[model samples]
Target: MNRRERRATAARQSGRTSPAALCQAGFAHLRSGRIAEAELCCQRALTLDEQHSDALHLLGVLCFHAQQPDAAVEWIGRAVQQAPKAEYLLSLATVLERQDRLEDAWQHYSRALSLKPDDAGLWNHIGDLLWQLGRMDEAARHLQQALKLNPHYWEAAHNCGMLLLELGRHAEAVECFDIAERLNRASAALHQMRAVCLSALNRFDEAEADYERSIALDPSLAETHNNLGLLHWRFGRLEQAFACFDRALALRPDFHAVLNNKAVVLLHLQMLDEAFAALHRSLAAAPDDAQTLFYLATLQLLTGDFERGWAAREARWRLPSVGLVDRGFSQPLWRGDRPLEGKTILLHSDEGLGDAIQFARYVPMVAALGARVILEVEPPIQQLLGGIEGVEQYIGRSSTPAFDLHCPLGTLPLAFATRLDTIPLAQGYIPAPPATRVKTWQDRLGPRDRFRVGLVWAGNPDHKNDHNRSMPLRTLAPLLDCDVQFVSLQKGVRDQDRAFLADHHDIVDLTQHLTDFSETAALISCLDLVISVDTSVAHLAGALRAPIWTLVPFNPDWRWLLERDDSPWYRSMRLFRQTTRGDWASVVDEVRVALEGQLSARRSRLVEPSPTPSAAPVPAAATA
Candidate 1:
């Protein structure tokens, strides 16, 4: 052979080696997850030979992994154009899906499936896309087919479970999760889904265990922590709930839902300053979040920051949940400016039954302005609210009254110019039914030589801040030591408290005999003093001109007003506030001292002349 022939052979071999060598390097880089390096190698191969299908396909995969979906699409499309392989088609489809071009993705995915219908992973991918497009039935079918082909396909099972959960088929969802969990025991998501299904079935204990397992498997699962916090909150374990919320925040500081839940728990614990700070942090993280804004406002109001409270309260009107119907009432909400002479106004109840009872004192003030007041109230307070003077009609049952103006029961403060000092101090707003009912209660008491005291250690279980406001029956141990006869005013005694009560049998349990709020009212009339936590019973006792001492959390409700030992709404009610958040020991000790003083005074008063007898009982005054 001549030198020229040898040189031509060497040049041809060099050309072939360069492209093949570059392609092999690119494939090696791609498998090792060196995306940038892999792209460079693939690009070098493409430059060496523009028609290299292997280089183009590898480059597309690199771009996809690097999150450059658009570039991935271009490269993958060219590769598919050069050689329509199943792998190239699937890669293109995935990139298209990432770009949110779902139709193109579906077409490519279908083409890929046509090439290799037995690929269970590809089937699962198609199912996920279909689910995103609202084709749940098709998605379920595809996912089932994938599981049939490969029973160990945990991803397909998980996706199918989620779909079933969304469709409210919790039982089927649980089954799917079980199968997936069995296949992949370490899968956090499978455990999480199972927890959700169990929670839906009201199996809280099981749900909680599964959630714990999921968190253990994946410590960074922020959502699982949030869900666990919610479960604790539901069970009235505020401390545990707050801990879970804190854990979620530690995992993802900007998680707004976790922040919101943390703030809520702080509020429940009566940690107002901390709660407010948490809320502010949440707002900083996610400004313009309507739910957080609403909650912030409610807390402000409940804490006696009236100016801020009213501002926050106004936000509720803008929320989609609040509806203002066209009742043909033209008059603007009376902000205490214009005369209400001869103008018909409707006072509607808002929120809960307790809220209506507390705010009903303002109804008479509205009517006092020469307006025909129609008081719309809950059924619980219908008979009680009717007795308030100046109310022209008790429109409690229906919602069809045509009035010139309407305002929420709680919003009356904003409308009626209710200053802290001007709150109607007239006790006995809700009179004790008729003389007969009062006489009946008086008869039940028979003869009592000791000072009669009514006690309520609990409030509504569903109250957002009940964990802080409501006390355990065991915590009332100090009161049990008092010389006075303790009459139980507690309602809906929890099973936990029932066990505690059974141990202390000396205290009279009047709760079983008490039927309604009316009975509570009559009993209050007989008692010399009523001691209770912040509850409806406290309001009722206050309204009946009874001497009432209310145990308030650190951040009390707005109606209690700010920094005062006595309530403006009820002159007879003395406020005993907690000094620190969730510290009931101090408040209970203070109450014990006050009760001792009252007992000593009663002993002294017995030696003096009998008190003057009158139809109207003497108003209870606050010593504080």
Candidate 2:
């Protein structure tokens, strides 16, 4: 008989007509993908005969497919209890596995295996459960058993490849993926897994190809897009990276990693508002993501939201990898109102040389509270920082000075209640050494007819945003052709760019003869004006009270504050900001205008000096 007629005949012989008919009807509905009708039929069968294992198992599988794992577990468990057969036990194990109860699932799987000892599918299920429970050795054993039972078990081979990749056995993982792919060439998941293994091995080209193939096969896979985005981001392809992240978000709108990556790229682009929006969206999806929180805090600080920034910055200590500083210093930190009498305070460098230079202005403020301050500085700035008032001792890397209390240099801003207006812009804070260096610089320059301008076009190359902030010598061609006598105050002369300056007699390259910061200070003291990009020389000129016009990038460093023409920290400095992101032409043009004005004023001053006393001529006659 045909299958339908055979089922009908069986139902008639069973004598429980309604239950048998409903079971047969349920199987037909399930085969046609009419899940709701199938579930209704199964429920009717179970109502007629509560211990009907086939109806119970069908209902459980239906619920599992519908993502109702709790209901699935209940029905499937009942089916297993009523009939301890291979199919019923497998159904129960599937439900248990879905609910992440691997141990319970393993027990049910073993029972199923006992009923069909050589079933490759059952062995594969057991292997997957074992792997989920972190029993890698047992998982491998079971997977091997599955393969032996049926040598063409592609699903088992694919899973083994994934586990091998997890265990860092890349070569073995690759082999498994290869075999699985040969067995089932249409499996997108297998291709994706192989791509991940290749990526871990740093075979990016092959990994990228596999990832593309996986995407072509399964266009809705968000994870494939995210992995591709990460690959592009690592290679510095910012635009391509953002595009991949955008595609991933389109598929999975609430994906946290994709949102975070979008925020990161926006931050790189200096689109702060857009970046913050992306971060907020990410937080909405995962409110307690620590890395996202940390990044938001950094953005806050970088943008000058100090109060909120500090609150978020404090959260770093609570993260897993952050180490907390012990309060073991000799002197107590003075939080504004505290009297520092009899306290031996240590002011240590926290971040970079530029940071120390900028914040070292606070040391005197600390000392004003009657503490004997010991300034711990990096070697390069030890001499320059030593001359500032209130520092009783200069502690370099070689020094081991005793201190009662210490604080990070950056933290001094909060301690002192430093508002923008109250910043100590006292010029000549760092003193130039006595006439010796002054005379030497004056002799080197000799007699210049034009206004002498000192220039520094680049800063530390290691700075993350150096490419955007520092200008090349070629970009400085406009300024170089100007009439003023230009002197190079650049510290390190890159060899390739040196030849460009050779033919330019108007540009005086004093970089080689410069000895130290002290000598630079003296030379800057003699210049009519210092024109520079953001660098240490800019800070030096500002501190020495030299009139300086600083070229600022579009998204200037945090110290410059936002939308300001002048720095509160340097009264002698004028800022020239880029009109657009990374567009230096406008900034240079503004500098040109300011330079011409200065030169004009200098000429006017030289030609229009105060009239000398006519009576001084009589003293020359008496001497003759």
Candidate 3:
């Protein structure tokens, strides 16, 4: 009999066409893209023999092609109930994945992998799904397996390269992108990702070119402009970075990351109000963004808004950028609300030595709260800090101490709810090294009347803001014009600086003999005045209540606050700020003019003159 006659005879004899014939008809209709006919045929077969897997599978796939993933998943799920074939499972997974049921799709994909171990497309699909799930290393490995199965798999290469870029394996990402570029030369995504990797490696010129190329290929690309803005920001091109961020914002107005970046550039340009507005926009979009919170906190602190600033500043402990000083302590943090009465509190140093010195003023206040304070400090300043009134004992980092609660020294102000007006003060808080330690220096010069000034033009080399804050020693030569003896108090001198020191006349090299900060403090004790850039030495001098002039950058640290000639933290400190960033000469001119005035007055004294406030040091802010 002909196939149609046989089907009709079977249908008449058994009350319907056989499931196999119905499935055959369904597939035949499906092959010709007759979706309606295929679906009806599959439904009839399922009604006759509900467990017919192939007919159900065909209908599920047909529904998927017909843009009905919900129906496809339901039909495929029914097919899976009857013994599942590998192909059927894959179709189910695809429909599930389209419905955003990633875990269910992953399980089916895994099952299919077990059935067809050598399928490259299966591996690639699973890899892409894993990438979506953020299993970066696993995704890359599976992608690599797909590429091994088929060497010309450009999609796999690109995917693996993108995961590698996310993982910060820049060189490996570059290698993968090169292979993908050969296969898909016109892809803007490929170029943009390659530029991202290059920028991370600080290959700025090449990265810039690639960013431009990506934008040229796809004018609608958003990330390329954002990344180019970041590259410009890295090299201090503030205006260009701002422009790029503006372009990115035009495309994606609610882009919080771009907004935060634009805020940072605005901050660099000293556009405080604009930066604040940008930060607020970012915070409104992503309130939990730790980096943005900390940035905003710094702005608040800079503007002397301590109440909200300190609360927001606590976000640093949770942020990756700050690395959240994870001491692994079981004790909870003591925010100001807690009563510390009879509690043993471990107050530990967190940041640099200078920070420890600056905030050490709060230690006594903590002790006054009836809390027994155990102070832990950096080794250099351990001895110096031991003299503070509140410490029960000074401990090194290696010591393990049992305490009821603990706080970083930086957190003390926050714990006390300290305001700008309420900052505790104790001049000569840090004592000079013992008389025995300083006797040699005391005996070397028999109290000469020549005006002596201790000088430090540079700070630690590794400080993040050192490039902007520190000046070359040669720039301080203008201070030599005044009739004052310049004494070099700079320790940890670079080899380059040593040559400059040797070339310069009349700078007593005390750095060689200075053993510690105690010795540095003793040397400052002998000087008429101390002049230094923002460094540990400056902090030491300020804490000791020495007549010290702090040479600060235009955008000084938040602790220095904004637009002030005096430090609230140190009563003895007189600030010489750079009106223009990197303009050390103008700062020196003010110092020189002040010194000339002081000496001109000193020379007029009939008898041996004592250094007084008749012609006291001039702050750079005063000069302006």
Pairs in steric clash, model 1: none
lDDT for model 3: 0.84
For residues 1-624, write the lDDT of model 2, one tens digit per residue. 348736745674686557767777777777778777677778778888888888888888888888999998998888778888888887788777777788998998899899899888888878888887889978877887887787688888888888888888887788888889989888877788899899888899999999999999998889889888888976778778888898999999999878987887777668899999999999999888876786787788667776666555545545654444444555575555466788888888766777777788888888888889999888778888888889899888567787777777767877776554467744647766668888888889988677889988888887766776788766777877667889889887666567777867778887776776778888887788998888878888888788988888876776776677888788898999886877888788778887787778777888896987675544445553
lDDT of each: 0.81, 0.80, 0.84
| Per-model root-mean-square deviation over C-alphas | 12.3, 12.2, 9.6
| Clashes found in each candidate (C-alpha, N, C closer than 3 A) | 0, 5, 0
**lDDT-based ranking:** 3, 1, 2
User: Which portions of model 1 miss their true places by more than 4 Å?
Assistant: 1-176, 183-190, 193-254, 265-275, 284-287, 314-341, 397-399, 417-428, 496-513, 554-564, 578-586, 608-624
The collision pairs in model 3 are none
Model 1, range 42-86, lDDT digits (tens) per residue? 777888889888888887888778788888899999999999889
- Give the residue spans of candidate 3 off by over 4 A: 1-175, 233-238, 426-428, 440-449, 494-498, 510-515, 601-624
Of 1 and 3, the candidate ranking higher by lDDT: 3
| Backbone clashes, candidate 3 | 0
Q: How many residue pairs of model 2 clash at the backbone?
A: 5
In candidate 3 the C-alpha lDDT for residue 409 amounts to 84
